[model samples]
Target: MATLAAECDRFKIDVIGISEVRWNGTGEFTNQKGGVLMYSGMPDEQDPHIRGVAVYVRKNVKHSILCWKAISERIIVVRFRAKKFNMSLVQCYAPTEDSPLDQKEVFYSALERTLSEIPRTDVIILMSDFNAEITQSIELGSLFPHKTCHKVTWKSPAGNFESQIDHICISKRWSKVLCDVRNKRSADIDSDHYLVVAELKFNIPKHRYEHPQHTRRTYNTTKLNVGAVKNEMIERINNVSLMEDASIEETWLHIKTNLEEICKDTLGYRKNEQKEWLSANSWELIAQRRSLSRQIKKAVKSDKRNYYVELSMKAQAASEKGDMKELFKLTKQLGGISFQSSAPIENENGQLVFAKNEQAEVWKRHFEKTLNIIHNESGELTIPRHLNPNRQIDTRAPSVNEIRGVIISMKSGKAP
Candidate 1:
């Protein structure tokens, strides 16, 4: 099973069906490389692994698996959700030609009923190692007409006979999805039957969270303490047109424009930070593991096989329980295990702003109003002792440190 999974990984197969996997009982287990393997065997504990069928789906695509069932020792059905439509994958191992007709009939009957049970609207892909030759006139007929250089699947042990017994059939509704199906004779898996690969063209849906896009701005607040930058910002703000009788909106716009221009010239902009959890060393180890796995499959001598096995184990161990750096990389590779919904925000009017643009605009108004407030209503007020008494509040120019501290105290990367 491990070797089979390694081959699947080597071939980059999204999903594969296995036949005659003489395992005892029906169950699912995770392979070393994280692929999902579901198999069905004899119902009784006393029975052996004969005629067992299984399906191995790659880790990346396993999340789309809706459900799976082990119908019998010879058949197992798995269903998956795709972008445009649902899909049902049926895998089976049919009785051999030498088997009794009644047994063959029972297998066919079960297979037919299984196919019938799947939703007619969903795309169906039926893959099986049917010991009966499809080339025989009484079988699937022209549905799988042979082409040159690929007339047979199973070769006799004596290298004398060959026949096309394995088959992959799709529902007529999804016939257009079939890109190509061919027998890969070069894949020598030590079995008389060659590997049959089928490629189907269908889009896989990418699930995403509907989160509001934030208009986060990054400012070089740390640069405000520089004497030259501080002086320049002050000079620019002092030159702004007050338009004494201008409406509140006009004055507000002028102040906003001047501040933005000065900040842009002095502070500059902040860049978006990219999250990198995976390290380079972890990726290299992964590549080495895959390479060693392929070599193990081809190694004939016991010593060479053992050498490859040890190397592969080292790679796997380095990936699993190695340094935090490598473990983080592996964790990043297995992404989206957790789901987090977007946080809600309150707008200027105390109403929630969930829409992307609306939220951004509301935040802008909020900061502008907050920063421009001259005095807080709850704070101590400077009032004249009498109606005629005059009062003046003394003010001093802010030092570079004070100016920089004010900017630093504000949200690090937030913009008004």
Candidate 2:
């Protein structure tokens, strides 16, 4: 298991799943690089030996365990948290020739029921050693033939033939594959059966709290008639009989190179379209949003004008009365009000009254509060009917837009 694990490590897999583990431990170990979020089955409290499935998460990834349940002697379901959303993972060790068919049916039924209860939206990855030979056949002589199933994951006692006993499967919602997927015999160490590893890149649902661990991706821009471009590429690939003669690597490499060339041409067409769009309307839209933002800023700045006016009056009166203490306080307050700058979050109400040097520690908090108030008092944030379920706002951005509308209505003659 350790040697096979090292082979897996070379692939830089985020998670490693083991079936028929016979351990109750969650499989968490600090030494595991990506923070192993492992869980093995021991559903029945009466049974002591784990005797089910287990997982190991790399120590680097942040995660939390949601739930773990053992459906049978071989099937286990484990749910865990990764960032904002919860993910469910199932590992099954189905009964083979040794175990009765009745047991397999019972276990599969329970497994099916357990899986059905889970909603389709959740990110799920189901894998296991389903000892049964999975057939790719359908009813009758099927016109739409199923892809041939390759069976060579488990080795026989004589070490001559390997059967497709070990397996990994996934749900339709989280359906992602790493191009070619097949059984790898190089990972067989001591566990009698060769470990089945498949490289899958899943597309998770877009959520506010969830973020990608991978680097930022740049999308390939499409041509003016994008659908036509895609069809053309498909046609070009079909023209070549590369698959029949060339190695899989060579065939895929040729396809990728052609794809890049086609995408590059499409990108050129896209750039021209963007230029035309800007020429037609984007400049005006940019000016409009900016103008509204400017109007909002101006209204906020004027509020501080009154504060400055009051402070000036106080300073003048104190100077005339020979009260240096009052004059200094007034001057400092006025000076504080004079200096303002942009911070992490843009201020909604232009009034960022700089605190005096003595009050520097509270500058950001005080300014933020003032900005929120200004935003609340003004009507700046509005969502149009066409833009329902808008993209998420930056956490640092002021969100008092909704409240500001109410404040404005009340301040104007419209309050009921």
Candidate 3:
């Protein structure tokens, strides 16, 4: 978790979808480095940790997490409340091609159900280690396979077989946000599967408040703690007129203008961070591979083609040799675990609400009626025989040890 968080920080990645985590049980935890890691796996203690899924979100993105559901060992989902719309990320590990047809069908059915739960307006990104080539089936459009030069994601130990099993799919509604998707073979993740990433362009909407839209302005309130800033703010506030006869609108306008001015002059504005994870060596190797691939695609002479293939095989072997402790830790954390549970709710009319929106409304109404209902029959109110309004409360300051002990009592790995 620490190594992955460091990599994400270096890459400036907001969120990463992961599969084949092989963990046992579902959990949300903050790693030692502060990034959020949420995972879902089998609940049974005896089951092997062969399949699991997770999402590692950077601190900035972690605050936006709305909810997460562990559907099964094969699937896990995390939903983020984005500015413009909700973003649903689904990570999956599907049955291998050699597995029974019924198992494959069951996995596909679960995946479909998961996808169906997401609202049409939300942005959906489906990432999976499918273990088989994908075909155009549902509205989720395949992105990486069609864009990369060497589309294969996995290579055999003998270097005799190459197949593309891992894939990324985006909702048809969000197809325009996709800039590109490619297989990063040079990524040294110490896995048989290469890293497949999709470049997306999303403009998060500004936060809206109850104030008049035209009169409102966003500010960096974080600077208020600086001594100089605080002094400046005090001076500015002191200089504002505050006559007793002043109209409410006039007073509000003055306050608003002062805040905007201070924010503009002192706190400044925020800038968007860019994401670019490739290291120098990785780029160089990728360029060489791409050129060789293009040359081969052009049907060059047999000798030249053979040379290109040999070089490509050597490069693939070198990539396979890279060691990543984090990858191994992920697998170990996933070893031997299984669990399962589900809940289905009914609507106000006693009919099941299959649609998400309807189900939400049904629950809202149920809670409102259940919690707010007033009883027609009344019961006698009893008061305590003895009461004291002037009871003294403890006012002594806490010692350093006492404060430390209180802090130590707080649970680690739990969300704030």
TM-score of each: 0.48, 0.40, 0.48
Model 1, 237-333: lDDT tens per residue? 7888787889999899988888888888889987656544446775577567657756765764577667656655555776766555554544554
**lDDT of candidates 1 onward, in order:** 0.77, 0.59, 0.72
Checking candidate 3 for backbone clashes, the offending pairs are: 22-334, 23-334, 42-338, 42-339, 43-338, 43-339, 44-338, 44-339, 49-336
For candidate 1, give the lDDT.
Answer: 0.77
> Where is model 1 more than 4 Å wrong at Cα?
134-147, 206-416
Q: Name the candidate, 1 or 2, with the larger lDDT value.
A: 1
List the lowest-lDDT window of 10 residues for candidate 2. 136-145
Across residues 1-416, which tens digit of lDDT does each residue of candidate 3 receive? 54466557766667887888888888988765557888888888678977888888887667778889989888989888876888889999999878999989999999999999888888998988888753322222344346433566777775545566788788887888888776666454456676666788875443343555555455676888898987887887678766577898988887788767767887775543344455777667755765675576466567666765665555555557753444354444434244342244677677855556877888888877655533344653333335343666677998999989978897654454
lDDT score of residue 47 within candidate 2: 72
Off by over 4 Å in 3: 134-150, 204-416
- Per-residue accuracy of model 2 over 146-193 as CA lDDT, tens digit each: 332233566677654445666566665455433344555444345666
Q: Could you arrange the candidates by lDDT from highest to lowest?
A: 1, 3, 2
